[model samples]
Target: MERVRITDDGFTTLFSTEFNQYYHSVRGALDETQRVYIELGLLAKMQETNEINILEIGFGTGLNALVTALEAQKNNLTVQYTTLEPFPISEEDVSSLNYQTGAETDLLQKLHHVKWHENIEISPNFSLQKVNCTLQEFKTSQLFDVVYYDAFAPSSQPELWTVETFTHVASFLKKGGFLTTYCSKTVVRRAMEQAGFKVEKHIGIWGKREVVRAIKL
Candidate 1:
């Protein structure tokens, strides 16, 4: 079963009993995502090109995609977002968490309800494809400019965090692409490095002292 959890900043996150994990850090879901994925991952990529392709490892509650769509509209940048989720959360669990109000709630609903494996325009500037498969199982011709490595923690799902998996995930990125994650573990950084990324660590907003940001140059 999954339940809604309120973080320190008052935004909501999902806690999974099956994995005994929270979808995001308990410190704050919105704040952490904005700082890690949006600022470090997407906006950093936007500095180089207006049109970008993004690949995400986990869809979870679709919060990352939701905020990225909003950013795309806000900055008037074009974004192609592809996300992989082996198991989607239930609709009841999705409705329980309130990330935004008014039209954005509807936007979130659309993100959740959209059909898997089909590219659909979510807004004028943002298009999305939700793939119902694991990162290991996902095969695509698309190359992404940035990757949001939001899989469950290594402790919970060690398989997803392995060196072999990172290599496959790295293959999905175009040259000079970025892969950002909320984890700063040495083993994680080493895996990314071995997978052909130039790794760096930056101070994070919550959950840990620093996070990993890898470039595919």
Candidate 2:
């Protein structure tokens, strides 16, 4: 059975039964996401253009998408976010995730309830399309300004950490687009580099020491 696991940062994340791991860092779910995907990936792209198109590999708990939507509304930026998830969390579990209260909680509800494969505008600045498929099965001619490579760890899903998978995902990026992930393992970094990215290591807090933001030049 699945359950909610509270991280060290007071926020809660779910333990994936299929993957047998926590969705986000055990130290802090919200903190880790804000640091990695938002800071290293989305915000960097936003500095260049107010309009952004984001491609996320996993829609696990919708935290990444929720945070992105909040940022877009706050900055008055336009965002088109697409996420891929093969096995979505059930509604009961989604409601149980204690991220925040009031409007933030409501926003999270909107994110989970939005119909899949159809673009829905959550706010004036943010639009989302959730695809219920794994990255290997995802197909689209569209390219994105940035990618949030928030998949399970290499230990949980080794197949996804290979050069071939990185190369396949790279095709989803537009020219100059970069992919940011919470993993900076030597083997993973090498795979990303071999897949044609200029990988850079960023200092990370919590359990992991470093994260990576790889650019496709």
List the candidates' TM-scores in order: 0.96, 0.96
After superposition on all C-alphas, the RMSD of every candidate to the true structure, in Å, is 1.5, 1.5
Name the Cα RMSD for model 2.
1.5
Put down candidate 2 lDDT per residue, 97-195, tens digits, no spaces.
Answer: 886556566888889999999999988899999999988898999999999999999999999999999999888898789899999999999999899
Model 2: ten consecutive residues of lowest lDDT: 96-105
TM-score of decoy 1: 0.96
Tell me the tens digit of each residue's lDDT in model 1 across 37-103. Answer: 9999999989999999999999998889999999999899999999999989998988887876575
lDDT of 2: 0.89
**Residue runs of model 2 more than 4 Å from their true location after superposition:** 206-208
CA shift of 100, model 1, Å: 2.7
